[model samples]
Target: MQTLQAQIQIPPEFVLISKVEYEELLNNTLDGKFLSLKEVAEHIGCSTAYLKNEILYHPRYKEEIEKWCHFPTSSGDHYRFHAKSLYQFLDRESVKLFLKKKY
Candidate 1:
């Protein structure tokens, strides 16, 4: 399995925050309002196919995402994810802490 480093394009804005502030933002987010798979792909600026196959479906990140956050659509096949949860998962512990400090 490949590391997240190989798949996602983390932005410079994210790189600039202190670890403490980041963690607070991640932990403080509310639990509702999710993003559909398509929305997530768009937010991450990646193709849906790429996100599904390489990031979501891939064995490594798949379990992590499923365990941390995921919701099945009404169809019960595709998954939807709470945007806040997804962000929390993607941002490192340090990043989350940094976000907290800013808020």
Candidate 2:
């Protein structure tokens, strides 16, 4: 086996996430809401691919997903998020309205 060295240069924006930012990412009323990416995708009935593509790419996505899951790296950075944030991302109310309009 060969050893490999690689440096993943994270964007400055992705680096400066503060504690306040993490706390604000959750809905205060949604108690004990932590989830993994697989959990979120399963709950939303979406593929992880869709989460990365549609949801994660939406203008409001970063703020939202960051509130819903974690990507804890070996760099001592805990990027965990809450679960309710996923519901907010789905915007079930808006989808309901849109479907109502369609029908």
Candidate 3:
């Protein structure tokens, strides 16, 4: 058998994160009122794919789904959801039932 040794390299600039700071960073990162698809799924206690399939693509919810998203007409922008709108969509059937349509 042969013995081997390896060397590790560090960049010129590196900042160490403290436990408290790390926790704070995590909290801040996820604390926003608006969320992406992944964040919305996490909030609703479901997998992203499940949410996308079961709710996002459901025919009964099609018009409402489009209404709650952050981007409606932009071809290149990713979809985002306002926390309030998402909650309303789930909690209030009236919102979906009375679709006046949005421009």
Candidate 4:
């Protein structure tokens, strides 16, 4: 009996994400799935505090964020994110960045 081993190369930009995150992305491709603030933060790979401060509350992205997120209470402390819309928002931002760099 013989054993063989092979080596695989990963690209520099390739990211290694946990199984939970992978499943979250795979399973939440539809528009109706709602995610809590914490889950959105994790999916986007940012701290919850940073998500709230920079993206959620920032003036530049606030309007777009609001389109896909909801505040369930009058206090505006809790957020529920629409998974597909959130992903689309991120994709649009990335494309904007790419075009900015190309010009």
Candidate 5:
């Protein structure tokens, strides 16, 4: 049996750190971080209105979206999304699209 290993070359401008340090930094950065609806919509490359109307309210993904988001006001006109959850959801959606195309 043989084992294979791969190495990734870090760019000149990038700093290399141990996994533990990276994890610590990530945790510190993400702790209690929440993004506004407009910020999230911009990050995902969609207009706020489109994000709210098409994906957030769409039947296929609304339930899942709600799990990671909250309406801060009684009117339900404002949304704040947990940073980690939003990233995870986007990653899952990306994988789903990839598999759909591959198959």
Candidate 6:
């Protein structure tokens, strides 16, 4: 058997998100609605592939998404998330920008 792993090159802008900013992004972006990946992509005006590649499937955000994205089950690359968690994961870059300006 052989294993292949593609190296994920994180952009220079990635940052560790604080709990408060994460919560705030959720509050601003979500409205207690549970949605599928496709729906979420629509809600945020992006392609589902973009969401998966940049946020969910990115190794840089794996730990954070595991903690906050609320994946209901572990099954391949297919996953679902509560709206808030999904937004938090998707909007983390924006949250980092917000934090940069706040302090």
Model 2, residue 62: distance off in Å is 2.5
- In order, candidate lDDTs are 0.66, 0.60, 0.69, 0.76, 0.77, 0.65
Candidate 2 lDDT score at position 75:
85
Predicted structure with the largest lDDT when compared to the true one? 5
For model 2, residues 1-103, the per-residue Cα lDDT tens digits are: 9999998888877765778877776446566766666776666676776656655555655664555567566886644556565566567544732242310
Candidate No. with top TM-score: 5
lDDT by residue for model 4 over 52-87, one digit each (tens)? 776778788888788879965677677888888887
**Model 3 agreement with the true structure over 2-95: per-residue lDDT tens digits:** 9989986767697667999988886566354778887877776667766666677768886787876764357767658867667767777644
Q: Which scores better on lDDT, 1 or 4?
A: 4
lDDT order of candidates, best first?
Answer: 5, 4, 3, 1, 6, 2
**Candidate 4 at residue 3, lDDT?**
100
Q: Give the TM-score of candidate 2.
A: 0.43
The stretch of ten residues in a row with the least summed lDDT in candidate 4 is 94-103
- In candidate 5, stretches whose alpha carbon ends up further than 4 angstroms from where it belongs are 1-20, 72-77, 95-103
What's the CA error at residue 3 for candidate 6, in Å?
Answer: 76
Cα TM-score per model: 0.51, 0.43, 0.50, 0.57, 0.64, 0.46
Each candidate: RMSD: 17.1, 18.3, 12.2, 10.7, 7.6, 20.6
What's model 4's TM-score? 0.57
Ranking by TM-score: 5, 4, 1, 3, 6, 2
- Please identify model 6 stretches exceeding 4 Å from their true place: 1-33, 70-78, 89-92, 95-103
| Backbone clashes in model 3, listed as residue pairs | none
Q: Runs in model 3 with CA error above 4 Å? A: 1-32, 71-77, 93-103
